[model samples]
Structure formats: structure tokens, C-alpha cells
Target: VAVFTDVDCAYCRVLASHLGGYLADGIALQFIASPLSSRGTPTYMAAENVWCAVHPHKAFIKAYSGGVPAPAPRPCAVIVAHDSQVAHAMGLPGTPGLIGPHGAVLGGYLSPRDLLARLRMDAATEPSP
Candidate 1:
């Protein structure tokens, strides 16, 4: 599963903070930081700064969940551009959109229970001989 999310959304934070639980359950969860206009437009500037910082991913996760923003931007421009391009290609118009292995797009915030249920449904629909 690929999670499209913004750094500023609490729901997205919850999902990221709890990623280990999903992974422990044998679920492969990949994240696509789909920073929306509300956050991306300005907050992404902060993200860019963090991207330039020593530990981009850690700095991002920390600041994203209400921590202090990083002090400086990193030297890498490609990561920022590439992430934006991927988000645009996926038709991601908002944050917290989830894509399954079969290309199913699930939008908005979902409680862990609901997410598990939906994943189960998707699993059940898989082709098997």
C-alpha cells in the first residue's frame, strides 16, 4: 500500500507514527509524501529546508508532527522535484490518499480498523487458482 500524505495533517502523522504496527502485521506500507497545496505551497518550503538538512527524513517526520521546523534546506533539488512530479502523476488533489497494489485509490483519513478492513477486502478479491 502506498500512502499519499501531507506533513501538516495530524491524520497523516498518526498513520506514519504507527507504520510499524502495519508492517509487523505483514503489510507492506510505502509512503508518498503528497504535500497538498494548503501545506505544500508553504509547508513544502519548510520540507525543502529539511530536505537540505543532515537527516531529511527524520527532520521531516519530526517537524511534520508539530515539532520545530528545520533551520536550513539541503542541497538536493531532485528529491523535491521528483516527489512533486509523482504526486501530480497520481492525480493526487489532496493529502492522505491511499493506493493499493491493484491501483485502487482511497481518499481521506481512515481509522486503522477501517483501513485493515478495506485491505482485507482487497486481499479477498485477489485472483487465485
Candidate 2:
């Protein structure tokens, strides 16, 4: 699953809290920054900070644990900004936008079990090739 998330989004935090459940259900998550804050704001910077860390995956996990790294390199801001831009371009209404493996829009912030069920249902409904 690819999730468009924000550092300051409570829903994103809830989704992060369910990381174990997602992984246990064989859902490999890809986090994409989609900050609700404008560029240069602390919240947006927080997303950039995660990208700046030597281990961004670890930093991203820590960020959802109520913390973010120090201010990021100016360069990293571009990547984070691009992530938000891409999410916006995709027309996602808000953070924690959930996209299923086969491009299904899984709505937002669903529990792992529910998400898997949705995925399975979608797969079942698809016409056989």
C-alpha cells in the first residue's frame, strides 16, 4: 500500500500505529509526504527532516512516534515538496490517502484487517483476464 501522509496528521499517526498489523497482513507500506501545512512550516519541515535522516525509513517511523529529526537539508525539502505535489495531483482529499496495490483508491485510514478485506473484495470483483 502507498499512503499519502503528513507528520502533523492525527489520522496518519493512527495509521502508523497499525504498522505492525499491516505488515503482519502482508501489506508493505510506502509512505509519501502529503503535508497539510504550507512549505517552510514546521510540519512541512518535519516531513523534510525525515527524508534528511541517514535512515529515512527509521526517521519516518520515529516521526510517527511523536518526534522528528532536526531541520533537514535544503535539498531534501524539494523531495518532500514533490511528494505533496504528487499527492495533490492525484486528487487525494487529505492525508493518509490509501492506494491499494492494483491502483484501487482504498479511501483513508482503514485498519489493516479492513484494508485487506477491501483488497480481497476488489480482487474478487475484477474480471478474469
Candidate 2 residue lDDT tens string, 1-129:
899999889999999999999999998999888898899888988888887777788888889999767655455777888888888888899989998888777888999999889888988998788
Q: How do the predictions measure up, each by TM-score? A: 0.74, 0.92
lDDT of each: 0.70, 0.86
* Candidate 1 lDDT by residue in tens digits, 60-112: 67776678666664455566667767878878777677888888876666656
Off by over 4 Å in 2: none
lDDT of 1: 0.70
- Candidate that scores best on TM-score: 2
TM-score of 2: 0.92
